[model samples]
Each structure stands twice: as C-alpha cells, then as structure tokens.
Target chain A: MTTEAPERRGARTESPAKFRGNPWSGRVSAIAYPAVFLLLVVLLWWGATSTGMAPPYILPSPEDTWAALSENGAYLALHTWVTAVETIIGFLIAAVVGVGMAVIMVYSRTLERTFYPIILFAQVIPKIAIAPLFIVWLGFGPEPKVLVAVLMAFFPIVIAGISGLRSVDPEALELASIMGGSRWKTFIKIRFPAALPELLSGLKVAATLAVTGAVVGEFVGANEGLGYVILQANGNLDTAMLFAALIIMSALGVLLFLILEVIERISIPWHASHRNKDA
Target chain B: MMTVETPSPSTAVETDTLVDVDDITIRFDSKKSSVVALRGVSLQIQQGEFIAIVGPSGCGKSTLLRAISGITSTTEGSVSLRGDQVVGPRQDVGFVFQRPALMPWRDVRRNILLQAEMRGMDRVEARERCEDLIQFTGLTGFEKSLPHQLSGGMQQRAALCRSLLHQPDVLLMDEPFGALDALTREKMNVEMQRMWRERDMTAALVTHSVAEAVYLATRVVVMGARPGHVVEEFTVNLPRERDYEETMEDPEFHRVAGRVRELLGSASSHE
Candidate 1:
C-alpha cells in the first residue's frame, strides 16, 4: 500500500543486494560435508578390508584402491578422455535433435500428434537393453555410444520444451494479442522467458542422463572410456580401479549439473527459484 | 462560431456508441457437452466513462472481454471500435486480465513496455511510455523489479500500466485488483480512482465487488448468471472529482453500493 519512491536523480535502487551470501555455509557445503562423507566411506572400506568380512578379491582396502589409482592413472586418464568425448558428442546430438523436435512439435500440431506417442514409447523402452542392439547395428566405434546418449537425453528436452511452449498462460497471450503481437512475438517474448525455470529443470535431468546413456553404450562395446575401463577392471578382478572409474563418472555428472545450474541462475535472475529477497 | 462548424455524430454523440458490442454470442464445445457462455449480448460505452460489469462467476464477463479483443470470436455479433469493426485485435483496445498476469521475467518497466516493443515502437518512445506509466501507477522505484518481486498490489499496478501503454481508447479490465488483500485492495481502489480521473480514458472493468463498482465507476451495469445479459444499469450520482476521504463518508456512495449489492444478491438467487 505504501508508495514506491523513486531514487534520487542520477541514482537508482541497488539491484536487490546479491543474496547476502554466507561464505561460511558454503564452506560447510563444499568442504565439511564432503570431507566427512569421504572420511566415513574410507573408514568403512578400511574397516571391512581389515576385518576380513569379505575376501581381498571382492572389496579392496582404501590403500589398495589408492595404489591401483596411482598405478593406472595414465591409462585411466586416457580412458576418461574417451568417455568425456563420447558424453559431449552424444549430449550435443541429443540437444540438437531434441531442440529440433521441440521446435517442430511447438509449431505444428500434426507433428506433435504424429511423433509424440512414438517418442513416448521409445522413452518407455529401457535404454540399457537397447544399447547392445545399437552397438550391433552401428559397430564398436563412438557412434553407438552417441546414439544411445541421444536416445536417453532427447525425451526430457522435448517434453520440457513442449510443455514450456504450450503452457504459456492464456492471459499473457491475451496481453500480447491486445498489444498487437504476432504469434511468434508472443512465443519469443512471453512464453520463452516464462518457460525457462521448467526448461532448465528438464535440461539438468537430461544432461545427467546423457552421461549415463553414453556410458551404457560404452559398456556394451567400446575399446576406451570409463565404462570400458570399469568393464576391463571387473574382468581382471580389479575392484579398486572399477570404483575409481565410477567415482570419476560421478564427478563428471556433478560437474555438468553444477555448470547448468550456474547458467540457469545467471540467465534467469528474475526466476523466483534464484531470487534472494532476504538480501 | 455557430456559423463556422457542424458537429459530427462521432464527436457529438459518442455517448451512444463509444463501443458497440453488437449481439455477441459465444459457445464452447467438448466431447461430452456444449456450454453457452453468452447469448445476444450488446452494450454501448461512452467517452471517459468508467463502467463496471457485475455478474456471477460463470456469467461470461471475461468471455465478453475476450470477444472484444477477438481472442475468441462471437458466434453471432461483432464489436466495433470508434466506428470500425473489430475483426481481429484492434490496437485501439487495451485489456487488463483478472490476474495481473505480468511476465515473471520482465521487470516492471520492461513489462509495461511490452506492448510498445510488440508494436515495434522506437526505444525513446517506449521508454517514455514506460516511465510515464510507472509514475502514474505509483510504481516509480519498482521499474527494475520483476513481477514476482512485487507485492500483489504492485503487480496489478504494473498490469494496469501495461494495459494503458499503447494509450488505447477503450480499456477493458477483467477484475485487475480482485486478488489483493482488503487493505491493499482499498489502497489500490483509491490509486485507481486517481488514475481513472487523470487518464480520462473510457474503461469497462468487470468486477464482483459492489463497493469497487460504486467507488470507481460512472455507471454500474449489473449482469445476470449464465447466458449472461445486462439486467440493469445505474448512473452514479457522485461528484466527478472523488477524494478518498469524502467518498466512503458520502451517503450516496453507500446507497449506490448497497443497491448494487442487492442487485448482485438477487441475480444469484434468480439463477
């Protein structure tokens, strides 16, 4: 009810002060918790190894894992690069295909009706089960891995984009109409921005799945990559190396997710999820 | 002076037909059933008049507004603005929805200038339009704030400014202030009253509140339930220049409010 007074001439209201960031809390989130969890896991692994609850061939000690890591660093790093390339290529393919599908689906009801059911059915079919078949068809090269990643990653983006485009508020459209806006203008200006929060949510899910889909394809047939390393390590009875590969894969996923989250925060400052009123 | 000029119908008696809603009817269809939203409804608005269309929830008040904007076309009749038939969206008509419906991504200034940007207005003009409007709505400092950042009252104020940015002759508002708290509502009512008087723009606001109808409107057009039609129209006898202090205290305002409330009550019972 109170009036909003204008700032003094040549001055403006400061952007709601960037969330009064608590660097202390960030330390807890980044260092303390991770340190504790890593310590706990290391302790558990050491205890299990020392107690001889399981044989050495099955679960190795923390030191054995470190030795394995040190011995295979060069080989693992090369294999890790292979996985990273496959993931990036596959994710890009999925993004392009998904964005194309979404654009077509948004612009044409006929396309949406024709393809929506088929895409949904494809999503329902397990991607892992399809991975070996993809490898059979496309051979042991990177093609199969990239294809599987696309299969896994495309659905969320398509669904997110469709709902984002379609779920534009009727009132906002009406406002655009009254303003003499064309359909495209309304889509670009209102629907696009409003759908950002949902679109980013779907992207996070899709991107994480992109890595998994690529690795699944790698598991079926690949001469390199983290998935290949894990498979070989398991075959050679090297549990530590397998665990290390798994850890690296998890780190990769987390890194991609954090990057996407950062982008969302920056691009959509107006989004309620990112706003800091307490600041 | 008499010998030099003659007044045209457009200039002289816009009072009869500032807005001619000619026999508009609307129907919606689904697999199971068909619903008739409006039937052969017609209305005429006048210059600088503040009219309130009061009706039940499903009485097609919003539907009628939509028809005027051509968001949904009438099965039967056409809306004409300034003697021109409104086939599609006419830039001359401004619409304010029930919800503020502000774009969450755009700040108040950018939101208000959305209409201008859509019309491809130049930057200077758009800025001027936004600045002038923000000030008019008492939202000067909220220029850089997004819709979610603003309170309900402030959001609606931004909505109002957005609607008026193009300076449309006929402003159609569908309960723009319906979602606010009572105290905020009262404050908005007072601010809106001031805006309405200053703008001298013809406005038709659809509202369920009788007190809101009484306070801001020059005429209250009472509407009935489904297959909505105007039941009665009351000409407000209050002074042209209404102050917040004198308005609530004035017995005439109370009398008008009460009568409109009774009309709304009876309309519901009849349905």
Candidate 2:
C-alpha cells in the first residue's frame, strides 16, 4: 500500500502536466498558429485584389491599405488617440459606477428591485439607435461619446459585479461572523476579493464595448475620431484609408482587451483560470 | 429526549462545564414549509474534553454544532458558554467547517492569520503563534502555498491552523474530514487528536462515522433524525494518549463502538 500510494500520486501529478502539454510548445503554438492564420488571410486579401477578383474601389489591395496607413499615419494617430481617450474615460466611469451599483444592490433588496428593471430596460435599447439622441441632448463634443461608451460598458459590469459579489461562499461569511467580523469588514476582506475574478471578466467585456460605443457616438455627430475618419473616407471613396481606419480601430479594442487580461492575471493569480494555465 | 451516560470523575462537576446547551430547538422556515432541524436537543461539553456527536445524515449534528457557535439561532432554548448566554457569536470560539473554506488568494500563513486580522490581534504576536501552529500542523513547508496549490488534506490543515490562531476556548468542527480519502482521514484523525490534547481546548466534532467518534472523543453523543434529538451517550474510558491502531483493536473501543452503532442503526431504521 505504501509503495502503491506514492506511485498513484506521482501518476496523478504527472498526468495533468502531460495532458496540459509542454509549456514551451503550447506557448509557441498559441502565437504561431494565430500568426499563420492571419498571414493566410492577408495573402487571400492580396490575391483577391491583385487578381482583380475584387476591385480596389470596393476592397483595396493589401499594399494600398498599408500605404494608406503609413502615408496618413500622423492624421490617423491623432483621431485614434481621441477615440482611445474617450473609450478609456467612459470605461473607467462605467467600472466605478457599475461596481458601486452592484454593491448597493447586493446589500439592499429594495434598491435592486427598484433599479434592476430600469437597467434592463435601458440595456434593451440599442445604443446606436439612441446615439443621435445623445448627440442632441449632450451636443457635439466628447460628452455624448463618453456617455454612449459608459452606457455600453455599464450593463456587463453591473451584472458581473452583482454575481461576483454574491458569489462568496456562505461558509466564509459564517466564518467571518464567527470571528466577530462586522458586515463592512466582511465586505472588504472577503466579498470584494472574492468578486474580483468575475468583476474583472466583466471589465474585459466592457473594455471592448467601450471602443464600439465611442465610435458609434462619433459616427452620429463628431468631426474627429476614427469614426469620423471612416465616415470621410467612405464619402470620398477612399477605400484604402477606410480600411486603414477600421484596422487601427480594431487594434485599439484588442489592445484594451489585452491590457485587461494582463490585469486579470496579476490581480487574481489564485483564481482557477490563471492557476490552471500555470499548471 | 436525551440520556447521559455515567460521566468521568473530571467531567462531573457543573463548574467544569465550558459549554451548556439547554434543550435547544432549531427550525428552518421556508415560504411553503417549516422543517424542524433540532427538537429539544441538549448536550454539555466540559473544559479540555473532546466530545464527538455521531448520527445518521440529517440528524442535526451540524445544527447542534452551529448552535453552540451561535451562528445558527435556536428557536426554543438557549446555549450558554461559561454561564453567559450566547446571544450572538462569542469571541472565544473557533469553528472549522467541513470544507477548508480558506480564501483562495491568501497563502497558508495569511489564511491562518485571517482569524487574527479579523479579531485585531497584535500583528507581531499573531505571526509568532501562526508560525508555531504551521509547524505543529506539519504545514511548515507549504506556508507560502495558495489554497489551490495544496492537496485536500493540507488545505484542511491550513483551515485547522486558521481556526486555532485565535486560541478559542471551544473548537467546533463539522465533519471536517468527510471530504478526505480514507487513509488521509485516519491520518488527520490522529493529528486532530494530538492537536486537541496539546492545545487543551474543548472540542465538539460532528461526524457520521462511528469509529471516528469513538477514536477521538472522550464522550460520544448519539443522535437520531426526523426532528433531531439526542438518543444516547457513551463515555470512552481509553487513555488520553491513544495510538490509532491499538485503539481500533482494543476491546473497550469495540464495545463502545458496537453499542453506538447499534443505537444509530436502530434510530435510522425508524426513518
């Protein structure tokens, strides 16, 4: 039994590591496979445009798009900065307000019942449809764009926050009380930390949506931002510039999402998702 | 109704009783129905004594433990600790749940020191005691490990250390080893026995295992289900320092274990 016990444990430990695959191979493939796929996509686009299967007016060639990107780099950079700043500001506001609302709702049934339906009603309305109205109400500056971004980002954060805050193990709360911890103390020491994994996941979704929200708002009324760049390029039939703007805009979203992923890894290293990756 | 066995000479005195549970009843009321968890259940725990309450599943063994900790309120009677009514959670009691319930983010040492952090104990003294406990529980090497990194038994050891950090007078455990494998469970039982003796703390363990109750407790309280109440009790005459293998084979262990099993079997048969 003694010898068998060690053997079983050794197998149990080794099997999971083996099943997860070699870390170096996994890491290399994770990047390599995506890069290969993207290269194929770029090649396909190049072939389509070069062969004239698709015209430059509708779908610009890869070279035309790349030239557009470099030639107008300074101009695109400015608009991208404007949109990125608006998105970031909106996302931050949504995060704070959404988490605050969730905490209040978790603590007070009255507030939850009162605000839940209204929040749900707001979520059902497409922000794109209401973007014009925000432009009308807040008038042509960053306020309307920021508001749209906040609205877009708010729902997921609130939902995730509510679930996260409520996800604490009941026994942990009992342990807190048994140790003479106050309600506030339990919230700070247990509930908040426990909620971080879910809350961060919500923030990740919000980060991407905030970019979309800002662009949509800009589309409605702005004379600046990547949305404006797309609008002007489309009107003048500058397909390459349009493609350039679209690519940079998506890059911004991906960048924000990646930042959140890094934050999630740092903040909740003990979380199952992060720990499993390490194993 | 409850029946107490002949008490040992040390546990006989009223003043020596650290926990006095007087005919407490716990009821759970839902929107549709009210379930009686405990009906007029009563038990007393003496200072520095190990009392194991064994019963079938749903026999209010856990409810009784929670009531003693004052986390669950008794609908009918009262629970007193050291002559003071336990109106709310008392400061001098530590509880170990079935699950380790350690904060996943905290390492073993921080998880154990959580008790001190909550109670506002002096940081320097608490860390000193925390190291001692980590060593005592054989978790010295894994002090920096997170809950997920440790095995089930090690996680539970961290939990045990967490509960003991405050040095509570009474330690209430609710099926703490139920999740472990048989070998680990037996090893933990031996460690638990040693920890209890070394700390000289009053402990009440709730388990469904008859042999575990017999092996650990100075006294065993057998309870029945369906509006749970204590049916019988047994006083183990074994010495405080009991070897796991010898105690399992001893005739005294068998006699008490057999009787307790018989009582539990009959009680569950009625259900």
- Which candidate number maximizes lDDT? 2
Estimate, for each residue in B47-86, the C-alpha lDDT of model 2 and write its tens digit. Answer: 8889999999998999999999888888999999988998
Q: Which candidate leads in DockQ?
A: 2
Worst ten-residue run, lDDT, model 2 chain B? B5-14
DockQ versus reference, model 1: 0.39
Worst 10 residues of 1 chain A by lDDT: A5-14
Error of 2 at B136 (Å): 0.6
Fnat of each candidate? 0.59, 0.61
TM-score of chain A of 1: 0.86
Cα error of candidate 2 at position B121, Å: 0.8
* DockQ measured for candidate 2: 0.52
What are the per-residue Cα lDDT tens digits for candidate 2 across A68-176? 9999989999999999999999999999999999999999999999999999988899999999999999999999999999999999999999999999999999999
lDDT of 1 by residue, A40-76 (tens): 9889889999899877788877787788778888998
Which candidate wins on TM-score?
2
Q: What C-alpha lDDT, on a 0 to 100 scale, does residue A104 get in candidate 2? A: 96
**Each candidate's DockQ:** 0.39, 0.52
N/CA/C clash count, model 2: 0
